[model samples]
Target: MINTILVTDDNVLDNAIIRNYLYKERYNIVSALNGREALELLESRNIDLILLDMVMPVMDGYEFMKVFSKTPFYKEIPIIVTSSLDGVENIEKILEYDVFDYIIKPLDHINRLILVNKIKTAVKHRNLISDLNKATKIIDTLSTTKNI
Candidate 1:
């Protein structure tokens, strides 16, 4: 189960709205004023997903992604960019960063639920792969023992 999420946005109202919505759905949340603060929170807490804003003071989404891509923990952490700029050009720009999805402002209930489910599915798939790798390791050990 996804226990928590990090919602990174400079706008207080946007963060509050999203936070309240998620909270009502029983998801614990942590809000970050900017990408830098988000990074710090991520380091200190176990966050399942990040709803990142494209523009902000301190560090922006692009900068965050650049740093995050290098770290093992951040590499697979699904990021859905939630911004008001959902124009074709803006979407193109964000897609270049390799985010999981692009969500526009005034997030509707249906789309929000879809986003949550997508994260759940990804987490499930990741866990299955991890399990498969573990099983393969065990099988390898057994085969080696038999050969010995």
Candidate 2:
């Protein structure tokens, strides 16, 4: 299945660059200008992943993550922070949101490869978790039947 990715960034050029990089992967790309828009999209779309920018107007990445984390339905969606902010402190701050990974902005060919690889890894992880949940449910049902 083709995964849908939400790209939230105030910079139009940055969004375009990311779109270009992911185009080859055939992701159903959805763009949002800020956190508010991203939240709105999330309400209506089954987004598989998110590419977020740290500094944005209306709502920044941290603010978005705060709300996203609190929402149980959104907690499973893996987020990859794509930001210009780079430092041990900054990375730690973003990591606190339970993001899948963080990538420095101004992406190039090498970074694009890195981003694609990370996306693949995250997708695999999500699929594994889903399968495990399904297996657990089946086991629970089997146990209940055996007890009857």
Candidate with best lDDT: 2
Query: In each prediction, how many residue pairs overlap at the backbone (N, C-alpha, C within less than 3 A)?
Result: 0, 0
Point to the candidate with the largest TM-score.
2
The C-alpha RMSD in Å for every predicted model, in order, reads 3.0, 1.4
Give the alpha carbon lDDT tens digit for every residue of 1-148 in model 1: 6558799999998888788877876777999989899989998998777889888999988888888878875765778888878789888878987787777776678767776676566556555656787999999999999999
Clashing pairs in 1: none
Q: Global lDDT of each model?
A: 0.80, 0.90
Return the TM-score for each candidate structure. Answer: 0.77, 0.92
lDDT of 2 by residue, 1-148 (tens): 8888999999999899888877888888999999999999999998889999999999999999999999998877899999999999999989988899999977888998898899888877767776788999999999999999
Task: Output the lDDT of residue 99, model 1.
Answer: 82
The segments of candidate 1 whose C-alpha lies over 4 angstroms from its true place after superposition are: 108-148
